[model samples]
Target chain A: MAIDAVIPFKPKNPKTRLSCVMEQEERETFARAMLADVIAASCEGGCSPRLLCTAPYLHPTAEVCVDADGLNESLNRVLSAASSPLLIIMGDLPLADGAAIRRLVSTEADMGIVPGRGGGTNAIFLRHPGRFRADYYGASFLKHMAIADEAGLSVEVIDSFRLHTDVDEKEDLVEVLIHGRGEARRCLQSLGFVLSVEGGRVGVERRTHKETL
Target chain B: MAIDAVIPFKPKNPKTRLSCVMEQEERETFARAMLADVIAASCEGGCSPRLLCTAPYLHPTAEVCVDADGLNESLNRVLSAASSPLLIIMGDLPLADGAAIRRLVSTEADMGIVPGRGGGTNAIFLRHPGRFRADYYGASFLKHMAIADEAGLSVEVIDSFRLHTDVDEKEDLVEVLIHGRGEARRCLQSLGFVLSVEGGRVGVERRTHKETL
Candidate 1:
């Protein structure tokens, strides 16, 4: 009955799409805050979380598994290492809460897959070690579902917006600004980010105030 | 020698995706303001502006062409009525400016197409009335380019961020708030929308304020 959660985090050179609006130092800081928030949610959901890392920055309490390979191999390695039910969650989900994570893990299916924003797999809960291979690239949710189906595994699709909204683009920053709480919000505010309305649209604005960090 | 710019304005039910955040009255007012902004930009670009409308709201000096048909048909009707070079601009481009429009029209190709955000046509400059049909639905920029190719018309793709950013989704409201100017900004400000950072994200928070209009 032990559930181990694997959170993949790319702390080095993170949130590049947000580079259009955020400076490099701030992007890294914001990414770490999001990772911390995701890890906190996983632990709060009664799961022992593991960090699969490429960079040196480590979450204080989570067990760190360093892997230099691509996302597929690193995740696969972590999945192989687990002795019980495994959960794979993306680090960028700032709005991930305990109830959502608990719901995902508590599902009765052999596997559960959650679709990410703009065609990616956000979260997957697998009961077996090698029931299906993890293909976490473009349009991955459908691919994961198909893999689970081919293996004749019962799959549960967890349709949760908070679990799906990964911080990927400048447009995505709005979701965080409008609905996000905790570390990510504090990081953005400290960076002097403000929401502005003009030209029939909304976006983040950092005034003459530069990042002191 | 003359360039007539046709801006299609759907003043009724402007941005439905933004219904998650903004009320109906605010969305309509915002859409009308964007239409006015587009008209001003078109006029400043040395193009005679015209509004092809389904509703009764009129831009002060621009010629109003009332149409009850669908988007594709209404646009085709306006195109057929024009004798000189015709320019088609979407009413939702709040960030559109005179420079972008001037660049679009000044292109020497038989057809000039500007790509919109989330895969739609933002602006089109056509020298021939029946050269290529406008397909402004779902990834229409590529569809337009293919159409122009089949018609043996030279297509010029004008790459401008301001012209490409169409205000359609709730996420798009962030762009307007961050980088917008004039009426749209003033309107949102009066609505008491403030950027709040929480739960590791940024979001809009209204504090003790209701829409005055």
Candidate 2:
């Protein structure tokens, strides 16, 4: 059976870290672009993606589950009712492609974790959904591993650069420009963001002074 | 029993890619620092680390295995005669600390692979050694996965930024400066390399013009 992927998204005020370089609307657009990439990659990996949005939002590719509660509460609500395998991935991993998604879903363990930079749990694959619960934020990777152990579920950790590089800080935009190939990259490029090298360091620079605020 | 870690080291002409920024001797010194860091991390993770050196070199900590053959041939020679659980990790992953090593050694699967940035296997944890051979070049991550599947051994992929970020190119030095806390970072800093921003991109720059070449 096809694994169901639930991507939790904050429709309002997303990507706030990019506020120094991107306007509010631009951040929203970029967030949606990343979400689109995630959904497309999930589908390509033979899984049906469903967006767990905090607010009402429209996406043509995936199903939307609107729940205004906190992340852990809402995700557990979904988990409690899940019957088959579930893949929970963040919306900001623009570098993740079908290959990464395929590896996550193909794990034989009861639970699989793809940890993000700075001890964050970016993506998770659960064979038996209700057997595990979600607990994100602040070294959540270690917390999730503990949760799995407490539940008596066998766990596997996936060490992937593409899956772990979740776009958050403005500096992280460089990775998207370097490795991303979806609408997110186009959105950044369309906004005049280009890769620049300053004193031997690779970063992003805006060529044009057009602000959309 | 504690897992035995085998770290391959090339004593002569190592890290040639950093030749533009670092001299040959400096590269060798930096490589040794990284090796020292890896050995320390392995020991801290409760594993006995052995340095698989291309030439006879002295390490204060780990035992040395002198093998003049190429990487594949030498590692295979060791893999063919393995007894207990073994961990094969590259010496270039200086950012990998005790926690990362601990996670790698604690996996429940037959084999756990930590892949490098570009389809390279950086580390492998094998429960039953001699069952799986070592293949370490050009998309060896995927190749190892296939080999495991062919051998009917279950596999788990560990997605870790510190473990996957192997220092190969000169640009990779930035990660060492940012996240590293060992002799490798100290070596780079002692060589006058500092984090600099070029047109908004983060990179390494030499503040002092003390060329060792």
Candidate 3:
């Protein structure tokens, strides 16, 4: 089975939700980092994906095909073209790791579901890639599972930290800062993400619930 | 007893993260709307927060002074002066419901931690008001809990969807679009975050695993 790595690049205006927290450059930087992560994972796997769909407007890169269609259309177009096993990843998932992707692709099951921490679908894979279509985000994890059941496809929910977090807002970035350690560390201190722990304590303590509540 | 409500107001900038997906003015407008959500929540509680901390400045209506200490320092000033109960709500936690706040406060726990589906604290209420001095974002959830323990105070993790899912990215906006049936329902749809799932599923569905792993 061929493992085709796909990152859904939604070039929607970054201002959509919690994205108001960082600058555009930072957001772009975040995307660049995610792409780097995908590249790194691909390198570890030592297998170049068959196709990569992104914005047609961006500069050409190795194995990346700029999908001229708008965000969702591009994703759907790529989803329709999968001839082998397909691994659909979110471009916003900075925490995605190579090991997780390899594990998911290596699975015996015909389908894969990786849930975002907030009940959204972070990453999904399918043996019959082109035929799979459903709501991309939101609480779509369970929905996809149900569809697989109806389709009679064996499904697997790969438990992974890398597949669980995707950054699209400021707080999501904060989550990266909090959870990412070592190389994957969000480099919060360098990125100027705020954290004020004085020797790991607030230092100010008082007791008064009756007074306020 | 002072209940200082900490909110971060984002200034209009082309560099802000939201700008990546939206125009600068659009980003600011979105940020303000989130601030309004907090303001509304505080109003429902019948107690105005002592301070409204914005990025690089404090609100004109606020008493505490925050001269751009970044998010960390601003929260520090408020937490330091919080001799009474302190309600620290994210500006983007639009789904945070008044009932959830009431329940959290009613518990009268030493540290009220409303963990986001992503594992971060969404709405945190300190009964001692000034007992927590740890960082605000990232892994600080677990870190702050440790801090409370070190300070000889109790810490309770309260699970509330309203308090946990703060909007920071586009996918979060999609979450609001999918599950906006709650308090922020109209607000979500009105903001142009519409994704017609066409009624398939709300979240991730299928799971494919490697047989070897």
Candidate 4:
């Protein structure tokens, strides 16, 4: 059976942390490119991709489910109704590819999780979806582990560089440019973003400045 | 200056979880082999390996610091007195290699952590050891993150499979057999341990069981 992959995305005000380097409109476009990459990866990994968007939106590849509620509430609704195994992958992980998705879903455990850079959960694979609930926010990775333990479910943490690297800040753009192989990289490159090395540190530098009014 | 790699190990009654699969003496030998692998990796990664054992022990390639006062206390003692960057890697991660260690210490953040399969912290690279303390045990990964946040330290979580996979159970031996290139793997294979596939699940089976009394 094909696992259901629920990708929760905020259509409005997305990638706000990248505001220092990208304009509001560019952030939205970059976010969509990332979403597209995730959806494609999900499909290639033998799962059905469904976008749990904050607002009404359409994606050609994935099934769209709009929810006004926050990330936790929105995911809980889908999780409660899930009949089979479900995978919840954050849309911002542009570096995640088909291989990373396959590695996560192939784990032999009741629950598989990929923790993000800080304390966020980048992706989760739940065998018994009805028995678990999503509590995404600060330290959600730890919270999810506790929730699974309380429910008497076995948890396996999938540690992968591609799955854990979520593009949030401007510094995160360097990874996407270096390892990304999808629309997200093209979008960033098209926007004149280039890698800059200063004092043995790599960061993104915008080559073309947008004209101000 | 070479970074100080402090490896916290319990020399006595170590690897109690693997007792079901191995005898007391076998577990001790296995634990030592794993520790040797980690120490070698640390040295190859440009850090000075130091075993912070619960009991007195000696190694040819690394220094040994015996502190019977539990894991947290012993590690904090070293962390408090450290004048340079310090790394703490669990002794059971036999799959972790020099590249894994290099990837962790190369991070630009003040702290870099590799979370174990469960909530445990497998490896930590602390740039400012005095500003932080060691906290191992249940959910130590999250606790360390909180501690770093309180100290106003930038944290980078290095998500790597080899670093995160620690040998605690009989099933974990499969990973060492598959990906390990160290004394631990040779020790396991020498004991006639081989991968056993039962119902599409991989496990370990002792080919030559010890003669019964």
Candidate 5:
């Protein structure tokens, strides 16, 4: 059976919550950089994923399949159209390496769900793509698990900290900087990113250097 | 009915998890600053209980009573010694203000349990201090709740994000830098702490200034 990968990319106004700390342009830039890293990791894991973008945009590293709908609908469309086994991965996991992806897809179960931090469904591999619909609502990992159980499909629970820690909050960026060595890290470094220690805890701080006249 | 706030502080090895990002001297300084802020907030809420420390150290603002023991034992000692109502508050809650403290102590229950983010007992207000002991181990919130239940005491669960977000990990520094505007923030600022954005998220970064010839 052929197995394909599907990555949902939201390039337009991505990481809006991060706008509390990053400007619009910077947020978009950082989001694309993370997407690039995710794409690279997926490719290295031996699965050329169909990049499903929310809006039409040029991905320098991967091909785009625009789906101008919400997350569940967009993902459902891709799964519905698929004729073989598929792996769905979120495009924000900066620490998603080849080994992690391989471990996730190498599961024996017909359906595998990777739980994210804070009750999110980070990645899922399905042998019957058309049979299962995507549900990305609150506490989605449990919901997806229930879905597989109700469907009477063998489900494997894939729990990896690196795969689970998807970049969502401002604090999450600290993890990326600490553990990540990819396009996202390079993008942050180019934008003058550095680690800051506050209240005996570590965080990220940006420094802009100006030429002295 | 006097409400006293007993803040358990470990100044020697405060926030050791943050050792991944902060130096020993820096951690000590920052921990003390956070403790000072917690003390000020507690005092403003009309509770000027003794600051319990594991080691003998002079606090610039709050009076320190050295316990020279571990957490549960030292706290039990203080609870046993106390004759009236006492509130135990952790020293690392940088976002804790007077209002949150007032809310916590104002509860009508005989025993109040304030929960931390990751299954920690952040603060507890005991109307009958001598009647109950504290269990501040892993997942101590549930243990404290069980203790209250077994004692047949009226338990009030005080849920406050400000009180819950303790400065335990590196990412926790983000909460302090974003929402905190007290001694802890000032201490970090004095040590060249600033905000940085990477991967569309916020973090704290330090920038040291050097003198040139």
Candidate 6:
């Protein structure tokens, strides 16, 4: 099935721990690369979801949402803009990659809603494919899930590591950096982050999936 | 405001993992110590609106559910067994401790539901006192939330690291052990269970909470 991947951009508070400390150049590089990774991962997983984008720097994305409306509006914009199956995402999310979206899209449910650990919808999909106005994604994930259930939509919350962690605070930056320490450890070294003994002692793990696509 | 903690016992697998690695005596010691930790911590937390009791160990918790019938049975047990506000807990949970329950019980809410990730409900409190018959546990957090909402009960999901990670698998074990590391690290440690990784390179920045208790 073809998908129109939607990323909603809601500005973050500078004081908000999740604000990006990376400069403009780094941010752009990260964004472009991240988008590319999502696209490539989707392709590898056999999902051909198109990108319906909205954010700080709109590139040659499928389309950039002009109004900086809140999350629901931005999500509805891209979801409404396309008639194809789609996965709506949080643009600020740096951890979610193609694999996560693939799993989410591949999930066999009438409506696939990826609820953030905190209250909010990280990524949502409509097997029916249309502009269904779901006014959620606020203070709570529980609230968001409740709204989905009331709409009579069949919802499934898939357990995916990448999908689970959305970079939202200063500490998130550290978490991701520490996770980078695989054979990719030098990547963190290059990025100028430190790995406390805590990082190694705590360790990291990812789940296995039945091959996607 | 008071807690009568109920631990529903349903063990999915044998205690082989904990028993196999450690000495037989050590395994028993570990279980007893763990139980003591829960009791002592609960006392220290000074939260339990009432009392904490364990259902006679019988079924695998995964088998014992919190659906309508199960919830009704548990609530009936709570009503008959407890004289104070009741907070329901699953006995299979090796990680949940007193500090977490205290936080759940002591926190002010007309009614409360401690949610587990991926549509599972951990613990719930009813202000009506000994009047709960809602079955919720395993994979039914959302259902219980709706039930509470329908009853016009104020429902809250308290943000506590100690409570969030439920041990259902090997990865969950890693996550449970890594709790109390703060929000960012807690989330990242969950990532580690799914894959092998190194020290640094990627960053998962969470907006740090001022963490007001």
By lDDT, the better pick of 1 and 2 is 2
Task: For model 6, report DockQ.
Answer: 0.03
Interface RMSD of each: 14.0, 9.6, 9.8, 15.8, 11.8, 14.5
Ranking by lDDT: 2, 4, 5, 1, 3, 6
Please, what are the lDDT tens digits per residue for candidate 3 over residues A1-213? 336677655333442454555456655555655656655665455335433444443534446677655555676777677677777776666556566677677778988777665557877778887667656544567567777788788887665556666665554555555545433344333455543345432211222344334
State the local distance difference test value for candidate 6: 0.48
Every model's DockQ, to 2 decimals?
A: 0.02, 0.11, 0.05, 0.07, 0.02, 0.03
Worst 10 residues of 1 chain B by lDDT: B194-203
Q: Could you give candidate 1's per-residue lDDT for residues B31-111 as a string of tens digits?
A: 877787788788878888888888776666888978878888888876777677899998887767787789889989998
**Candidate 4 positional error at B100, Å:** 7.7
TM-score to true structure, per model: 0.52, 0.60, 0.46, 0.56, 0.52, 0.44
lDDT of 4 at B113: 93
Query: How well does candidate 3 reproduce the true complex, by DockQ?
Result: 0.05
Q: Local error of candidate 1 at B67, Å?
A: 19
Indicate whether candidate 4 or candidate 6 has the larger TM-score. 4
Count: clashes, candidate 4: 0
Q: Per-residue lDDT for A184 in model 3?
A: 30
Model 3 error, position A57 (Å)? 5.2
**Local distance difference test, per candidate?**
0.76, 0.85, 0.59, 0.84, 0.78, 0.48
Error of 1 at B83 (Å): 56
In model 4 chain B, where is the ten-residue run with the lowest total lDDT? B195-204
Model 2, TM vs. native:
0.60
In the range A1-213, model 2's lDDT, one tens digit per residue, is 678999999989998888999899989999999998998888888889999999999987688999999999999999999998999999999978787789888988998888776556889999999999998876577679899999999987775678888898887887787667899999999988987655434577887755523
The regions of model 6 sitting more than 4 angstroms off are A10-36, A48-65, A97-99, A129-131, A178-189, A198-213, B1-213
Is candidate 2 or 6 superior in TM-score?
2
Model 5, docking class: incorrect
| Residue B49 of model 4, lDDT score | 86
Among all windows of 10 consecutive residues in model 2 chain A, the one with the lowest summed lDDT is A195-204
